[model samples]
Target: MEKVLFKIAKQWIAGDTVDDALIAAKSAYSLRRHAIINKLGEYHTSKKQIKVVLEEYQKIVNSFRKWKIRGAISIKPTQIGLSISQKECNRNFEKIIQKARNAHVFVWLDMESSEHTDETIEIYHTFFSKYERLGIALQANLKRTDNDLNDLIGMGAKIRLVKGAYREKANIAFKTKKDVDNNFIKLMKILFKKGNEFAIASHDTKIIQKAQSLSKKYPRKFEFQFLKGIREEFKSDLVKKKFVVSEYIPYGVNWLPYSIRRIKERKRNILLLGSSLIQSHRV
Candidate 1:
């Protein structure tokens, strides 16, 4: 049933075209909700496909400026031709960062698998050294992330901290919910103290509880970010408390992979809520 729901969720996906992503972004912006639009395809099969992806991104960036919208667009390194070459990836990112500056927008680099963490950080650093409008993601579940935060802190980097999605080796990532939550809290303190621009990207009640308490400590520096279809109630509660709330707006017809990941991730979210994870993904 979960798989079936995911199969049907493809309709909720924005579309395969650049125009579809723009329409969805406009709607999200109109709701007084900021979006993080992303092209749905990943792991490009050829450089040509990657070029197509970059051109599409250029279109999205341009549309955001032309439409006078305020939001962000997130990109997976692999989707932007990362698998082919890191040098090329860095070049592509540099170009986009420049374009993003003209639009008065930010570009968030989405975290991928465990193997790509170091390279991703390096890519971010290389550009962040020159670009200020760009932000990067960090997953709390990784063992080395605490130290990674230390390095990023020295640079005063902006971050969106998530509980991580990619399945990783036991040595590199904790499998238990308790361990992951504990690590997330520990890292949360570091980000809060660094006084860096940050977002709490998780749906765990316990994590939200921690952020609620922590928000009193920072006043307005921290925000709670959740995916569009998950954890609907907390957004209002946080805004009422005067803490910022950001929703991740993922749009793309190739939602099959993202939907599948959401289903597997539901198992973890359900564990957090002490409820069943199943949901009908009616389109």
Candidate 2:
């Protein structure tokens, strides 16, 4: 039954087209949640495909102003041919940033696998050198997270910190959940101390508790971010507390891979979707 539901989840993805995402973003923004619109395909194989993806982004960036929408975008480095060449990735990123900034929006560069970490940061910082609107996401589980945070602290980068979803070797990432959470808090403390503007991006209850408790001490400095359609009850409770909150609303045609991954690791996500279905179709 779990397997069955994950299968259906793939279909829930809003597809590749801009209109599809624009509609979803409108609803998300209206709900008092900021959305990080992600157009799906990762690891493009050619420049032609990269250009097509760029055009897709332009479509969304243009619509945000046209429709008077409030949302930003999350980008995967590989989607614009990072693997093919870092230069190619930088070129593509610059194009996205130029277009997004012109529309008064922002772009958050998502950290992919470990292999692309260095080049990704290099490219991201290169952009940050020019555009303050281009932001970056950092993973707390990574061994080098602290160093990265320290080095990039003064840039005023909009960072969304996650415990990291990708499976990695024990040496490169924290093997225990406790370690990850501890590291997350430690990093959060650093960010707070440095007065860096950031989002507490996670759905973990204990971590959220720690954040909320700490946030109470400095209520005006932080915001919590979560994925759209996940952790609704918790988010509601957080909102009631008056802490700024956001939903990472992903749309676009290539969203199927995200669904496939959720199905593949259904243990973490299946319950969130299954609960709603079970409640609706109670026996």
Candidate 3:
């Protein structure tokens, strides 16, 4: 059973090395889609492990320059040092930003569960002031996101809107798919109206269509982001239409949790997986 599962997981996860990730990014470039590479471990309690992850990320930053790929890296705060102390996390993150700035690569902060939301946003605010190429992901499932989106837009912060994957209390997050989708649409409307240089990161066909319609109306600077291997055909179609698309490619040895989360995030994800498998063969 584990082997079978890993087979499917491989379709989503790039591989367990920096070179594997670079190959994935190169593939994205060949498809005429941008790449957002991520190393898939997080919530580190050990400073040693965190330091290793941070250094790995710096290597990824430099590697991006060496490969000359128009790509970015998405990092979880906890993976750096957020699980230890905010001061440590801030120090480590600043190191990454400085290196990334020199390499001319973009950095994205991946929002974790609700417990880390405030600190993550604080980190984004602190760094975004110094780094214009930084962006942060905002979860639409959270009730507070409406206000948060407004505030981030006012700060001219680049944002990536996602229907969040983490589970939370009903009071904290919308529990039903309909409610979540509705909130996602509402937040996306706000992005089109007020935000600039943002990303609509969703694999839902309806949500992608809605973003297309909103772009026609508001004409904001934005791009569509889909997970690598999940919607190859759809992404190609959008690329053919001249829409900017990015593939979020995650690579690491810690692939099980991320793979399971992709399936368990919502019931529709299972259906989407099947659709992707079929569409992938066609593509």
Candidate 4:
């Protein structure tokens, strides 16, 4: 049953190995779409587990250089033991960052829930001066993101702007979709004015259209980013319009939990899984 569910989940996950992720990324590259590869796992408790995760990322960096793949890597803070100790997490991050820097591949620090925001930012700041290829993601839905963006912009940081995914309290996040969208645009405009480079990571047509319109006015280098398998047609359309685009591809044995969280965040994903199961049964 797990294997069956995994088959349905593959619409979102690339596969269970680094090789699977590379294959998916290469396919995207052929279509002029870049990728952000993430190994699926987070909130590990033990140092041993964290070390294993670090080694997997090291292998991924090596593969990126070996294949000359046009993409970067994204990692969650907890996956590397940020919850265990900030200092330990920093040590783990440095190892991966050094490998990425040596291979000339970019590393993106993925923002988790609101709780880890400050520490994640601190970690990013610690290495920002040392590695120009490192970037961090920001959750636009957070009430504090505007100030965070301002601070990052002052440092000329590259950011990947995303709508907050993890569930958070009403006091800390914008509850409605409209508010999140408005804040995202607001932050995006600020980035265009002051940020060095950033990614507009959203699938909303209205948001993408707003960014497209803003491009005419602000005219900064930015790319559109979408999750794998969610909006292929729209992504291709963006490519046709000559906008840079990238797919966020995740793969690993931990896909089940990741897929569950995604489904909880967006209930429509349940329908997507149901459709996948039906199609597979027919096949």
Candidate 5:
């Protein structure tokens, strides 16, 4: 059953090894799109577990240079050590950044639940000052994201704006697709006005079209990001038009949780993915 499930999940998941991720990245490169590789799992409480995760990230960063791929690594804070202690997480992230810096690789800090937002931003700020190759993901669903985006832009921080997959209370997050999409566009306008070197990470065609329209007015240094298997045709079209595109890749044995989160993220994700799956079959 597990094998059967993995076969279906592999549409989006790379596989259960770093080699699998590298293969996916190489393929993305062939299509003229960069890759952002992430290992699945988060909220780790044990130091031993954290160390293993940290070392694996270090290994991934080291491999990027040897593979000759133009891409970055996205990491969940808790997967490293945020669940254990902020100090430990910072130490581990610094170690990875040092290695990545030497290799000229970019590092992205993925935003988790609202509970870790403040600390993750703090960590991103600390390292970003010393290392310009670092970027952080921001959730557009949060009510506080507009303020957060403005503050980070003032700091000249590189950001990847995501539509936030974690569930949250109605008070802190926009609960409906209409509301979240509104907030996404609201924050996107701010990025075009004053932000640069950011990522417009979404699969919504309307949001993507809005970005294209805004780029014409502002001409900022930004790029579009989509998951590994989603929107392949659109991604190819964007690349052909000379727009920057990136494919987010994840690989690990812990695929079940991530797959569930995708379904729970938004109703639109389900429809979009369903359409993609059907289109894939037709091809």
Candidate 6:
């Protein structure tokens, strides 16, 4: 059952190694799409495990450089050791950032759940000036994201706006799809007006249309980002219209947890999986 489920989940994750990821990324690039590659795993307590992940990222950086792939790497704080200590996590992050910088590869800090928000922002700010290409993801569903956007705008930070996937309390996050979508547009406008560069990350046609409308008014450096497999046809149409598009490509051995979290975040994914299973059984 687990193996069958993993097969369904592979639509989201590229594969389980840098080589596999690059192959997937190359395919995307061939279609005139950019990619953001991420290795799956996070919240580690062991220093040895953290070091191992760091090493994997370094390999990713080297591969990007060698292949001349026009993409960046996304990383989770805990994957580098944020659960152990912010200081330790920062140290590990800096090491990867420095290597990426030398290789001219961008490194994006991914925002996890609400608990790590403030610390993630602080760490991003701490290194913003030192690393010019560093970027961070922001969750639009969070109630405080408006203020967070305003604050980070002053720093000229590169931000990726996501609809947010983690489950949070009513007080902390928008509870309804309508509210979340509204907030996503609101935050997108803020970034468009004030940010230096940003990525509008979503698969919703309505939100993308809203962004398209807003872009005409508040012109700035920005692009649209989507998950690798979701809405490929729409993404291609957007690319045809000359809008910059990037795909978030995740790859690693620890795909199960990531896949489970994805399903938990979006109930529709379960229906998709069931449909796929039924079709496969028919086959």
TM-scores of all candidate predictions against the true structure: 0.88, 0.89, 0.97, 0.92, 0.96, 0.93
lDDT of 5 by residue, 1-283 (tens): 7676565567889999888999999999988999999999998898888887788788888888788889799999999889889998998898999989998899999999999999999999899989999999999999999999999999999999999999999999999989999999999999999996899999999999999999999999999999988887889889987999999999988898887787688766667776778887998
Output the worst ten-in-a-row residue range by lDDT, candidate 5.
1-10
Clashing pairs in 3: none
- What digit string (tens of lDDT, one per residue) describes model 2 on residues 1-283? 6566444553344545778777777776776666677877788888898888889888888888777777788889999889799888888888888888788887888888788889888987899878887777888889898989888886667677787766778898986778888999999877766746778887777778988777757644667887666676776777777777777766665555677655453255667666544543553
Q: Once model 2 is optimally superposed onto the true structure by TM-score, how far is the C-alpha of residue 190 displaced, in angstroms?
A: 1.7
TM-score winner among the candidates?
3
Candidate 3 wrongly placed segments (more than 4 Å): none
Worst 10-residue lDDT window for candidate 2 reads 6-15
Better of 1 and 6 by TM-score: 6
How would you encode candidate 4's per-residue C-alpha lDDT over 99-196 as one tens digit per residue?
A: 99888888999999999999999999999899998889999889999999999989989999998778989999998878988999999888877878
Candidate 3 per-residue lDDT over residues 90-197, each given as its tens digit: 999999999999998989999999999999999999999999999999999999999999999999999999999998999899998899999999999999999978
| Shift of residue 96 alpha carbon in model 5, Å | 0.3
Clashing residue pairs in candidate 2 (N, C-alpha, C atoms within 3 angstroms): 15-252, 15-253, 16-252, 16-253
- CA lDDT, every model vs. true structure: 0.75, 0.75, 0.91, 0.87, 0.90, 0.86
Candidate 3 residue 150 C-alpha distance from true site, Å: 0.4
lDDT of 1 at 256: 73
lDDT of 2: 0.75
Instruction: Compute the lDDT of residue 193 as modeled in candidate 4.
Output: 75
lDDT of 5: 0.90
Collision pairs in model 6: none
Q: Which residue pairs of candidate 1 clash?
A: none
What RMSD, rounded to one decimal, does every model reach? Answer: 3.3, 2.9, 1.2, 2.8, 1.5, 2.7
Positional deviation of residue 164's Cα in model 4 after best superposition, in angstroms: 1.1
- Tell me the tens digit of each residue's lDDT in model 1 across 30-65: 755566777877777588888887887777888877
Candidates 2 and 4, the one with greater lDDT? 4
Q: Model 2 reaches what TM-score against the true structure?
A: 0.89
Query: Which regions of candidate 2 deviate over 4 angstroms?
Result: 1-12, 260-266, 276-283
